[model samples]
Target: MRGKSAKYILKVDDDMWLNFDVLLRILKTGAIRFSLGGKCNYGQYPFRDPKNKYYVSYSDYPMSIYPPFCSGTAYVADSDVIKQILTISPNIPFFRLEDIYIALCLRKLRYEITNIPGFHSTKIYPLACLYKSPMVITSHGVSASELRNIYQASCDKDGSMYVPKNPQQLPERMILEQRWPKGKLARKSFKYEQQLLKHNLF
Candidate 1:
């Protein structure tokens, strides 16, 4: 936001699924200030191998481990800290990883990031979990079609809560990772239906 028009900025990976209502919910609380929060990681070791995607040169980062930082998957930052981070970002050496790099800049600005509980980040939760949980849902490493389905599932207004593109296939398809096989996903829908019957979540 560059301290121009917005008070806070929420950054989330494209593949990750989020409930927009949750974002509004977080903002309406008027509690988030000064600090960034998301799926924060700690004591992460730098990859020494050159073949790895996250490999960092000793010159770039010679330390044994990275400072506590938020995962790039998703995070929320305020305009004040964002502006400060921008001012210092140029000074810090370039690191390929955006999340880690942002955290480094934040570290330079003397801001600490903590993990927020509702940010169901990183690991892909089951459809039932996404249906039942009223948290920040993030399903990383999903394909374009799968991303669309997951997004649709969360946003679906029907009490049935079935995916639009291909309901039968969606429950069977790999929504995010290839964790779910063909027929196993029906169970998720079963629980969702049960919840619909019990709580009548719209």
Candidate 2:
């Protein structure tokens, strides 16, 4: 599919379960010249709001053009766009991480990457709510088992529109804190500096 002139690309996470029929129905809009699907997350960073500092909404700021951020899944402009991106001078080095690089490329080209809602795990809570207006395009930090449970429960409920899934078992605070050992110091200093550079804050 990457080699062909695809009209759209649907990127799916390992755990995502989608209703293609429903997706097709919603994407019939003419404004969308091409479509991309996948889970995206805005990088973690804080922003200043005049009076004080606060964490920016992931969907806002530099990533606003891409809307939902962190490109695990998405569609691009077929092989042409892909080829052009790959051909850029000082070709981007091959890295273990690829999604951010792709997002940066699309950003440089001024492409509009919109979110396709209702394309997330069916096992998460309030699955039916995804069908409502103002759709949700992505989910983050969910494990494979959690995704499986969601799919199973969605099936068991006979596709009822409003079935609620069990609350997710969140990781312990000790674990969470372990993941961010430097805490406020790291965020206020090193992380802050990196974000400033990425967003051109200076």
Candidate 3:
């Protein structure tokens, strides 16, 4: 990463709606330069049900409430933060929950996470709400059609799409039918994020 000249590293999941147009402008405007930015989830409890995919064994995480962590859907950390996390990772035991693990590392490093607007990490906002948001970044659990529609609306300068109606009235895609990649494939594709992190490219 040092040789590559990348400044910020953005980690995102496959099932998300990203407004790159708004993100590009935000990055160029240099709003979240120092802090880790994302839709942060606070005091989340670790799932304990054995049948649940996110289940964490009692031995793995005995705490009732976890430390504040950004939703796994999306988050950004600067190169310095990344390097620091790598340096400290040897001490913290391996954690299966990706976002929580990052938060643990950040906590060890005394790094703060800045909750940026429009991350919508847990749910998708209405199209109008998303389109109008200046800091709009990512929406979790979006279908392919939903992703395409959101991106198209972002480019619609003349307001052909993304009408500003009440959220309930809008044609909102509330469910995602997409199937996520299993264990190994998921780990591999995590490194497959966009190169826009390098040199703040649009």
TM-score of each: 0.70, 0.44, 0.69
- Which 10 consecutive positions of candidate 1 have the poorest summed lDDT? 159-168
lDDT of 1: 0.64
The lDDT for every candidate, in the order shown, is 0.64, 0.42, 0.65
Query: Candidate 1 — which residues are off by over 4 angstroms?
Result: 1-3, 120-123, 126-132, 154-177, 181-202
33-111: candidate 1 lDDT, tens digit per residue: 7888777889999999999988888998999999888878888877788878888887998888898889788888788
* Candidate 3 per-residue lDDT over residues 1-202, each given as its tens digit: 3455977788888977676666666666666676677888787899989999999998999889988888888887677788888899999999998899998988888878877776767554434333444534686766666565555443345333433333333222321112333466545544322211221111
* Model number with the top TM-score: 1
TM-score attained by model 2? 0.44
Q: Model 2, 1-202: lDDT tens per residue?
A: 2336554455556544444545555556633453233444554343435455433444433443332334554332334455556666245533223555666566556555555444443332323233221343334344565445444442322232332231122122311221322666555456433432342211
Which candidate, 1 or 2, would have the higher TM-score against the true structure? 1
* lDDT measured at residue 128 in model 1 versus the true structure, 0 to 100: 36
The lDDT ranking, best first, is 3, 1, 2
On the 0 to 100 scale, the lDDT of residue 137 in model 2 is 38
